[model samples]
Target: MSEVFERYERQYCELSANLSKKCTAAGALDGEQKKQKISEVKAGIDEAESLIRKMDLEARSLQPNVKAVLLVKLREYKSDLNNLKTEVKRLSSGGNYLSARDDLLESGMADTLTASADQRSRLMTTTETLNQSGNRIKESKRTMLETEELGVSILQDLHQQRQSLLHANNTLHGVDDNVGKSKKILTSISRRMNRNKWIIGSIIAVVIVAIILILYFKLK
Candidate 1:
């Protein structure tokens, strides 16, 4: 990230130097060179803006005390980039180049200082807001982490309960199988007892009839 910032700074410095040279020249730049330079400057500005946005996100991820200082620096970098873009645009416009160049050379220092002071003032005024926003982001992330942990805990408990229920169901099935086997044994025993009772009664009646026939023959 610092590398990105440094690259942007170098490109801005080069653009500034080129603009200063053009200011000193009494004539217009070669058409092709001017167009290429403008294109390069524009690309540099876009890259710088992209880097600054990344820096802003990095700052927001930090602690509030650290984020506040970084936010201020990012704002300053943004302001400087805006100023450079304005100067590049002035340099690229052929019709107003002379007047713009003269004005830039004359008032650049005072204008930069003034812009710096104004940016500092604005940053100071918004420090509390920036800090508050950083704190909110920090809190939100913390809450999300806690919620994720809680969800994991709940899933673990549910899994444990499911395992317990499965064990209980298996035990119930084993008991039911044993009860079914006991009922089948009892039914077989009952059928055997009924068959034996009928055979014993028939044997007793046959013996009594034999005794009566023997007594009657002896009396005759």
Candidate 2:
């Protein structure tokens, strides 16, 4: 079970790192390149999710106690996976594509706008494309902000869990210490009782001997 969780964690980290690299490169990439990278990242994410589902199923088939930790870790991995997906979508819809499209439109308009009728038509088309791109950019920004907020919430939850675990561990340590002290006190009491029993028995034996000797002397 631990091995399966480790494997899942390794895959998750690899996918996340790869996605991070692609996101960094996305801004520098041309539209076609960015699109290709996005597709590849999406495929990687899908593969990771498939493996996670397999691991989750395996965990569920185990005994309840054994499955509990795995289930918790799996939940965390799922949250991270969601964050990664949001990041990839944001990177894939970056402003680079919009900027490139605008550049192409401007170049084309400059070349064709020598004729007044062509200029008017080109201007209308360019304006519509710009407006559409702007709307998309706005939507993407909104989505990215929402995703960021969710990621922050997940981090906070994880932090709280860590703190709770730490407190539980400390409590267990205190219990152990108390148990050890109790054992020592019991051992001391047992030793004292044994010594007192031996002493009392010795004193009784001596008194018996003294009485027997006195009776023998008096009778003789």
Candidate 3:
């Protein structure tokens, strides 16, 4: 039983780390970091699964009596927990803790199995409760691991969006620079065209004046 607990704890830690890494990777803006986190998550998940298999094996090796006792306790605990949950909900809605606590205690079963119920029954009940609680705790821890993974994924998405925005900004700035260069080239071409028009006009006027001077000299 103690070994089982130890195994469960080890797996819990591994699972948590894996989930965190996954979330981090998913949200990572950097490709390299995202890749690394993915690897870490994979390794962690594998390790946790291996630990779970070992725990299952240990559980199966226990005596039938122990298993039966555990089942009975689990059923009882579930019933009690469910009732407590309902009462808690009701109390919460009305903002009344005092009444809720009273209801919980009244519904709860506290060490009710006396010594007369046979040693086998007692042992089974105790072992079953311990094992079931342990399993439930482990499951809850794994749930947290999943939550962490989701968080990492969200972060990675944000990172990617930031990168994309930066790229777009750079592209827009480049376009602006190109447009400015094109405008300067167009202005220079316009100025050259104006200078050429003045030169052509002067040449035409001189030709016309020469023809008129020649005709007048011949007549004289």
Candidate 3 lands at a TM-score of 0.44
* lDDT of model 1 at position 184: 93
TM per candidate: 0.46, 0.46, 0.44
C-alpha displacement of 32 in model 3, angstroms? 75
Better of 1 and 3 by lDDT: 1
Worst 10 residues of 2 by lDDT: 109-118
Q: What TM value does model 2 have?
A: 0.46
lDDT of 2 by residue, 168-196 (tens): 99999999999999999999999999999
Superposed on all Cα atoms, model 1 deviates from the true structure by an RMSD in Å of 11.2
Question: What lDDT is reached at residue 33 by model 3?
Answer: 57
Q: Which ten residues in a row have the lowest lDDT in candidate 3?
A: 109-118
lDDT of the structure predicted as candidate 2 = 0.68
lDDT of 3 at 160: 100
Tell me the tens digit of each residue's lDDT in model 1 across 129-215.
Answer: 555666798899999999999999999999999999999999999999999998999998988888888888888888888889999
The order by descending lDDT is 2, 1, 3
